[model samples]
Target: MTLHDDAVRVLKDWTAPDAPDGAQEQLRLDYLDHLVSHRDGLWRSCLPAHLTASAVVVDPVQGRVLLTLHPKVGRWLQMGGHCEPEDGTLAAAALREATEESGIPGLRLLGDGGGGPIPVRLDRHRVRCTGRGRPENVHLDVQYVALAPAGAEASISEESLDLRWFGYGALPELTDRSVRELVALARRTTG
Candidate 1:
């Protein structure tokens, strides 16, 4: 199927009962509509491709953010995974992933500007892999910000060697540029 059609299919999964409510839903629908309307045929050819959703959980109090040292890429990255049909919304998918990867239950999802305990509507970006000999591996990531309580416990999943919080100012030492940008963006927007 075409990319737009695929996006629509994914959107249906996102809006199910388990999904986030109101403005977050609207943002997700709007984003899907934009994706559906703008394929222009090229993305259609990239069929069978995978789409992923991720969450960046930030502890504003410590000026620190959570990251995973992914086993596959061996780089520090945000928490996320492939968008499965069961995941109702992009944010839901992100939350599910963050919960699973970080082993942090009851994570509060914050979007861009909601006054709820957790804000809603966060920045989304695409990841283009650039290793020495490998071509780019593209991941369309729908990023959401959430909060993990201070000194909240975290553990490394088999998929990652390390799962830890780092001071935003020290993100430069992290292995991935995309994650660094994500950290920077989270600091700006969260601030």
Candidate 2:
């Protein structure tokens, strides 16, 4: 399926309520428990499980946060992607994504430069082909926080249809609840 098409599918899953039979709901709960139970050990092991990460870039002086409009997820998101084997560190991956997506060269490490094994909630979303024609099943992602140097020049990439900085009190019209929550979390930390 095309990235656009897969996105539509995931959105439907996210928004639509599944009035599944009681047994089915129980099954889902059981699966989720199993997934969580194994996730930590899995993360430490060499396995192609649903593992990924992202960075929350904040401009503290401006009291605003940086967000990217990802083509696949089709929503504004933290700068992040899959954790590749060769990545020296998770924080480095987040830094790489933040710079590549924003063209903001002077982002500074904040909080713990290294982040996670923090549990994150994943939502269904899609993205354009990073290069391949077929769309991929995107993972639910965990992200870390990095502070952007005040007055750093930043421009949005094609991966993002738009990019903007939003203050704690004022946020753009957005559909992703996780993005909003992250913004609020960053605001609390910064303030």
Best by lDDT: 1
Tens digit of lDDT per residue, candidate 2, span 5-71?
A: 3222322332222445453344334334434554431132323234355777888888878888777
Q: For each candidate, what TM-score against the reference? A: 0.65, 0.63
Q: Candidate 2: lDDT of 126? A: 45
lDDT tens readout by residue for model 1, 102-160: 98877877743542222222333433434355545445455667778767778777777
Runs off by more than 4 Å, candidate 2: 1-49, 112-138
- For each candidate in turn, give its C-alpha RMSD to the true structure in angstroms: 8.2, 10.2
